[model samples]
Structure formats: structure tokens, C-alpha cells
Target: MSGTKPMGTDEHDAARTERLRKAMRCLEGGQFAQARVLIEPLCDDRRADVILAHALAGSGRSTRAARMLCRLAHDNPTARHPAQDMMTLLLRHSRLEEIEVTLRATLRQTPDDIRLYDQLGEFLLLHGRTDEAIEVLIEGCRRHPSALRTGNLLAVTQNETGEAQKAQALLRHLLSYHPQSAMTHANLAHILTVDNRMDEALHHHARALELRPDDPHIHLNHAMTLLKAGRHAQGWPEYEWRLRIPGRLKYPAERLLPTLRQDSDLSGQRILILSEAGLGDMLMYLRFVPALVRRGARVTLQVPREILPLAARIYGVERVIDPLRPVPAHDWHCPFGSLPRVLGQTSDIIGAPIPYLHADPHKVLVWEDYMPPRPGLRVGLVWGGASRPGVAQAQAIDRKRSMNLAQLAPLATVPGLYLINLQRGQHARQMIDIPEGMQLYDPMDDVRDMDDTAAIIMNLDLVVSVDTSIVHLAGALGRPVIMMDRYDNCWRWQSGRSDSQWYPGLRIVRQDRPGAWDGVVARVRDMLLPARPDNP
Candidate 1:
């Protein structure tokens, strides 16, 4: 048997290698549990330590993987990449203590390692230890000033800690040193955007795009900047790509309706106005359905059932289909927001007609008596929207978008102005401090649907809001509205236009810079100063 033994005939050795390879394949296929089964026999194998570390990491025992990575890194200093990878994972898990411990140990072994310092500093920032992250990164950057990772984090953390100018300097320095990294350009562009330097931000974003055209995040950021700069010709197309983002709503591939691109006469054509995104988006785009009908096509408005009754009424359509139902036959379908793009709209070519909707006479009569007469100007206000997922994250007024609310305190002080609370929801809790008598009514008790909203708006002299759907509703109903906006405003507002092209009676009050509610409020105040008899 000894003489018959081959050069490498150890059964266990062959089996171990095969099992490890199978575990790797299982991991690659996303079967983590199956991978663990194959990995159990090789726990003590030095050759399989990294694989074991990765498996443990997948199992959520990342601290153990991190320790294994640290030991491996100490023994094999040239293989420090694994250590950096583990640090990144730990940072995501918010395991700050383990990160700090591993980083310190690695730093002791290779004090001059810039990558180690960078990882440590980034983790500190992720954990909200911005001051310490800044200190560590700055020291490392001073030692190895040209290291992009160290310099980038130092700059970002500095900006996070309220030292934007210093952050800008570091980023610009890195850009000057290494102009090829799209990441550096993207970071610099974001900082510039936050600093209210639109021109510089645009330039940096364009540069980043030049380096990496297909990067979706950079594309989204650039599109936002363009929309903010009032350059919508390029923004919407980039914005459309947002559907591809994880957890974002996906319209069917058939929504584009290429098969219906035939030039056959529209005398019998079927058109579908598919709702995709938010209630506001649905309402905003419903204006185009009439145009489709005018082309002799049979048009159907597909939307969430909650808004169907109101949309059908305002849009003047006989058919409003719920999207949750099986789609009926349609020759063509497109997203609600795609109307402008499909129609090839530009600023000068856009047309807006007000009061496109009519409230029921009965509802109007009900509100007419329910609403008290105002002594002077009647200004309707809506401080919140439904707490739908979209509103909570995208449209809801947070501390940043809501500086106008605080500024309205001064508006209340202006005599001959009856401020009515069309506001609703838990967000109304923010208005508890508003002085009494400024409020004319709180119709929220009866305001449940668009009919109620329209009745209340029709009775008011004017509406004032901060980028909520009520602004759109008021504008659609031909009520004069002054829309307050933040620096990073929504795309629908367009950039820099004092008046909305989408709503003829709507005037915009945008921050001269982002987050400057004081200036926006002051502008609105100046426009509505105590009316003289001559002006009135």
C-alpha cells in the first residue's frame, strides 16, 4: 500500500479543495446557507482563511471576519486589500469599535499606510464622529497629501463638520493633482452644489460625466442641477432613468407602446395616459390628456383609485381606469411625466390655461356659507400632505424645505390678511405657535377629497404654499398662488422663473440660494405689502 501511494493521492486534500470551490460557487449564486455547509470542514485551514472570513461576513458575524482579516493583514502586509474591504463592511454595519481597533492595529504595523488612515477616517465620519474623522484624515493627508482617498474623506468630513471652504480647498487640490477620478469630481460637484455655487457645480458635474458617462448617480445629480438651473431640456431624460433605481416604481415595458407607432389615422386610436410616480405627478400631467383626445384618439386616464374620481372630473374624461386592474386594450401608453418630453416642450413654447377644472356647484355652495368672510385678503395655506411614502421622503416639508413657515409669522403680522389653515395631518403640530386670529378657518374636518380641496380653494382669494400638491391643485383651479421654494427645488418648478409656465396664475418665490427661506419670505412679503387704495 505504501509503495502504491501516488505523488498526491490524499483523499481529504482533494475533497477539501473541491468543497471549497463548491462553497465559492454557492456564494456566487447567493445561496449563503449552502455555502456555509461546504465551508464547515475547512474552518482551520490556513489556505481557506480568507474564504472563511467572507462566509462569516455573509452570515452577519462581520466582526469575526474583520479580526481574521486583521491578523492576515499583519502577517502579510502586502495583502492589506482584504483588511480595507473588511473595514468598509464594518463601517456599513456601524461597528465603529471593531473598525477603530482594527485600524489602530494596522496603523501600528504600517504607520505610513495612507489607505488604512483613509478607511479609519471614513468609518469615523459614517459613525457621526465627524470631528475625529476630520482630524485623523487631515493628519494623514498632511503626511501623504497626494493620496486621493485620504484627501477625499478629509474634504468630505470637513464639509460635513461645517468647514465647506476648507473642504472645497482639499477637493480642488485633489482634482488638480489627480483629475482623472470621476469620484473626486462628483464629490467636488456635490460640495459646490451645497455651497450654492451653481456654475461651479455644473462645471464639476459635467467633468465627472465626461469621465464616466454611464454613472447613474452622477447623471441624477447633474440632472438635478440642470433642473435647478432652469435647464429642463436635458433634465427629464436623465430623471426618467430613476425608474431603474432599486425600490422605485417600474412601469411596464409596454408603457412606451412602440407597436402603436404606426401612422394609421387616430380616428379609432386608443391612447392610455398611464400614471407612474406620485399623486402630484399624476395631477400635473393630466393636463395633456385633453390634447390627446383632441387628436381624435379614444383616451383613458389610468391612475391610482384614490385619485380616480377627482382626476376624471378635473381632466373632463369619461373613463378613468385603476392601474391595479387588468389593463384594457390601448394602442399607445406613456407615463404621466413623459408628456412634456414626448411633446418636445421648451420654456417659450409652453402654454398654461387656468381654471381648467370646475368644482360641483353643490359643493361650492356648501363651502360658500361654511367659509367666513375675510376682512381683507384671504390667503389659503396647506402645511402638509397625506403621509404617503412619496410625501414622507420626497414632497413633505422638512426643516430644510419649510423655512417659509417660520417666515410666514411676519406675513401674519400684516393687517388685512386673513390666513386660512387648509393644512392637515400630524405635521400641523408645527403650527401650534402661530398667533391667534391669523387663521380664518380649518376645513380639514371636512376636507377629505379633491372636491373638498377645490371648494375650499375656490372660496379663498389666494393660496400660498411650499411645493406641495395643493399648489398644483390651486393653480389648476385658476386660483392665484405664490409658491415658496428651497434651493434644491423640484424639477416641475423649473429654474429661476418667478412665474410657473404650467400654471398661469402661479407665482414662484424661490430662494436666491438654497435653504434661504428668509430671503424667499422677504420677497413674498414685499410683493404683498399692505395694499394701498391706488394699488388695490
Candidate 2:
């Protein structure tokens, strides 16, 4: 009986080990559902619980996974797996308070752990708490003077807080000691790029890439630097690495079409163009469809439902379909942003003829009555962009690219300008502060989709907006546009350009410094006052 018991125990142990191995493989392959099914039953096992928490996070149960990870980390502080997993889940959910508490508690238990300080500071910086992050990282560097990563993050936080010189000094100092550190070089390259020191930035960028050839982020940064320098010949190919970046939009590999070599024949080919990224991006990139059709290819565009009506009117488009519907048969597929790379586009060839898009004349006439017959310059105003609440990355961009109606106070003083409230979403409450004498019309209730917005724009004399889809809509319709750009602008705008090469007659009003919307508003006010002299 004892000999039989030993054999039975051996068989049971073998089965458990095999199951664990299979579950681990599933997790590594991103089959989180399969992994969760296998892991949930083994939660009693401590090692399995860590993997289970990860599976829970991957499967969108982030809050539950965070709680489980916190328990595991509290129970076993020596193993970093649980703490690392907890930090990732908490950051993704933007639970900043919980992250601070958990990191502080862990630091108390292991007071000398430099890694905890690095994690705390980096997480704060990611959430845009730059001042607090700098303070923590300074202390971290003081305690562990040899920690390169801590120093690097401190420098980055300093850069974010508008201390570019300090960031450069710290990064250069780090390089003096650890010249082989690819991260320090990359950070320095980024700061240089932001300062518009392209030649020096390219030198450091090349050095960093040389040191870390396998790093996708480094490749992505190099690509942008190349594009900024107008070296599109090399930049386009490097930009393909963006697909490998975490948290960026990922297309199905199987659906990706073969790269169209420069000036390659597309005759008889059926090409599918995906509307990737933001609405503005779709409007900007749709210009290439006609160019593709010129090469004799049948082109189909898949766009969001809201933009379908406008996108259907693009020249040379064989069909416009909803992205939610099953895609039609095609020989090749490409994301909208990838057209420049595939079609050999460059800065010199940009700004393909304007008036590529047209609004329905009937819809345009309908909106004319909506506008008051005021004897003034009609202007459309969009002060805010739609963004998800409580998301760190989205909030950060919104903070830079969006503003409250109150910030446009200078515009209210511009006489002979009839302002129309083109602002979308719940942010219209900001209009409550629109001084008693100033009148900004609100017809947003009737504005249903881009089709309606396009029609409304066609009726307006000019469109004044921050970086939003409205700017793209006006530009595509060949209406005059004034874009209020942030200090660190999008790549499509290119660097140090007051006028966009992609959109003819588009004027940019840029912030001289970050968060300085006052200057931009004042400039727009100054420009408007002279243009409309009939008011005063």
C-alpha cells in the first residue's frame, strides 16, 4: 500500500507541473483567456497566484488584479514580480493615490531599495506630476549616486517641468560616467530634438541607435528625428517600427499589405486603406487615395461611421465602408499614416491641391439660416477636444492641446467677429463665463457628425481652433483656418513652421512656451481686429 501511494503522488505531481508549464506558455504568448482558465483554479498556490493576477490584468479586470497583486507584494516583498505587476496595473488604471501608497509602503519595508524610488518617480512623471517626481528622483539620486536609471528619470522630469538646460547638463554628466548607457544618450537626444537642435540631436540619436540596435523605441524616436530633419528618404522605413511599440495602435499583421516600393505599379490591384489614429489623422491622410487611384489601383476606404458621409466624397475612392462592418476583399491593405512611406512622399511634394473635400450644398444652405445675419466676420471656435477622463496619456495631451472657453477671453474683445460655438462634448459648460456682453452662438445640438460639421464649416468665413478635428475639417474644405498649436506640436505640423505644407491657406498660432495659451489668444485677437475694421 505504501509503494502504491508513492507512485500515485509522483503521477499527481507530474500532472500539476505539466499544467503549470502549459499555463505559463499561454501567458507568454498573450493568450490571456486560455491562461486565466487554467490559472484561476490554482490561486491557492502562491506562484500561480502571481500569474493569475497578471492574467486578470491582461483580461481587463485591472482593479481586481491590482488588489490581488498588492496582497501578493505585501506577503512576499523579496520577490519583485508581484510589486512590478502591481505598479503596471495601477499605472494603467491611473490610480495615482493607490500607486503612491503602495510604493511608499514598500519603500518603508525596504528602506534602502533604490529600485522602489525609481519606480515611484517614473510613475509620477508619466502621470504629469513633474515637480513631485523631480523631488523624489533627486532624493533617489542622492541616496544611490550610481543608479543611472534614477538619474535619467530625474533629468527627464526636469525637462518636462521646462528645465531643458538642467536636463541636458544632468544627461551629459551621466554620460561622462556611463558613456555606454544607451538610455542616457536617448534622453539627451530627445531633449535636443525638443530644443530644435536637429543636427546635434541627430548625432546623439544615431549614437543611441548604434548602441541599442534592437530597441524599438529608439528606432521610433530616430524615425521622428529623421522626418523632422526632412530626411524622409530614410525616415519612412524606420517609422514602420511603431507597430512594435507597446500601447500604440497595432494592426493585424495578416491584414498588412506588402510594402509598395517607390513608384511601383499598382495596376489591377485592389487596395484597402485603413482609417487609423484620430479623426484629424484620417482627414489629413485621405488625400493619398486619389494619388493611389492615379496608379490604376482600385481603392477602398474604411472610416468611422461619423466620417463616412464626408469620406465617401473623396476623389478616386471606389467605396467607403464602415470599419465595424466586415471588410471587403482586397489584394493589399495599409494604414492611412503609412501612405507617405509607400507612395514615396516627401516635404517638397506635400500640400496636394486644396478643396479635395466638399460639403453637401443643401446641408451648407441649411446651416446658413442657423447663423444670425450679423454684419461681421463669421468664425467657428473649438476650445476643447473629446478625451477619456482619468487616462494619464490622454489627459496629458488634452492639457496641452485643449483650453477652456474662459481662456479665449481675448477673442471676445475682437469686434466685428461673430463667434459660433463649434466646441463639442460636455465642455460647453465653460461658456457660462462668456462675459455678459459677448455673444457666442451655440448650434452644437444640431451638429451630429463630421458631415454636419463640414457643412457648418463651409458656411463660416474662418475657423479658429486648437489642435482638433475641426481644423482638419476646415482645411479639407478649403476654408481659411487658424490653428492654435501647442509648444510641442504633432509631427504632421512639422517643426518651426507657421504654415502647414499639407493644408494650403492654413495659418498656425503657436504657443511660445508650454501652457501659454494667453499669447496665442492675444495673437489671434490682434489678427482679427485689423481684418474686420467695420465694428468699432
The prediction achieving the highest TM-score against the true structure is 2
- The runs of at least 3 residues in candidate 1 whose Cα sits more than 4 Å from the true structure, single-residue gaps closed, are 1-66, 72-170, 186-206, 216-222, 225-265, 314-318, 345-352, 383-399, 404-407, 432-440, 533-536
Cα error, residue 185 of model 1, in Å, equals 3.6
Summarize candidate 2's per-residue lDDT along 1-536 as a digit string, tens digits: 35544457888778778888887887677676788898787778787887787666666665666567667766765656365665675455555565566566656655566777788787777766778888888888888776788889888777766688898998998998899899999999988887778899888988998899889999888888888777777887798788777755445667676555546677988989987877988888777677777777889999998899888887777989987888788888898877777666533234357887889899999999998686889999998887767676566677778887887877877768899989887677888678656789988888889899888888889999999888988998899999998886776677889998778879999888877889999888887885445534
Cα lDDT tens digits, model 1, 1-536, are 36775546688788878998998777566454577667877878655776666556656555566567666666776554566665655445555565576566656656776767877776665555767877788789878988887888788666644567888998889988898989899888877766667799999999999999888888888877776666767776776655555654444655563312223245667777777866767767777666555546777788886567667774536478888877678777777766655544432113235566667677888987766675678788764555554342343234345542445676766667777787766667667666553554666677777778788788888898877778887888888999887665665675556787788898988876545677777677676777687545
Our tally of clashes for model 1 stands at 1
Following a full C-alpha superposition, what root-mean-square deviation does model 1 have from the true structure? Answer: 6.5
Q: Once superposed on the true structure, which residue ranges of model 2 sit more than 4 Å away at CA?
A: 1-82, 88-99, 122-130, 244-264, 345-348, 388-391, 531-536
